[model samples]
Target: MSVLNGISVSVGPVLFKAACPDCRSRFELAAGALRLAIGGSRRTTFYSFTCPECGSAVRKPAGERIVELLTGGGVRTLRLHSTV
Candidate 1:
């Protein structure tokens, strides 16, 4: 536990479980290892990560639950804006 600005702050690494479709490998990834993109629609909303087992880049559609978990876990987020 640490104190910042006179407030108690607890920090820890956040891990998320992910599966790679190409390699069929399942593993846990730290929040820093994941990227979440929220777009205007479900079709555009997704998350991506590099597979540790096969070293392949994996992308998957993120539903409401997924979005909630990833965001709550402190994963980096990118908001997508449409050109139109």
Candidate 2:
């Protein structure tokens, strides 16, 4: 792992490795690559990402521990407000 001209090359476990389900391309992404949304309901709390290789939108449910790790790791986050 090396940083070339400010670009990181997976120096450590700090960066997450994701696999695109559509294209099957594996790549390393920083916490910035993920987005977390916390909502009024437990079912609404989750994380989202776009697969760089296939351009497919991917969303996964985030549990309590996941939310903690993601937030601690610097992942961008949004809070959802219910109109009802």
lDDT scores of the candidates, listed in order: 0.95, 0.85
Per-prediction TM-score to the true structure, in the order listed? 0.85, 0.73
- Write model 1 residue lDDT over 1-84, tens digit each, in one string: 789999999988888989999989989999999999999999999999999999999999999999999999999999999999
- Give the best candidate by TM-score: 1
User: What's the residue-level lDDT of 43 in candidate 2?
Assistant: 98
Please give the RMSD of candidate 1 to the true structure.
3.1
**Model 1 lDDT on a 0 to 1 scale:** 0.95
Sliding window of 10 residues with minimal summed lDDT for model 2: 10-19
**Candidate 2 at 17: error in angstroms?**
2.9
For candidate 1, which ten residues in a row score worst on lDDT? 11-20
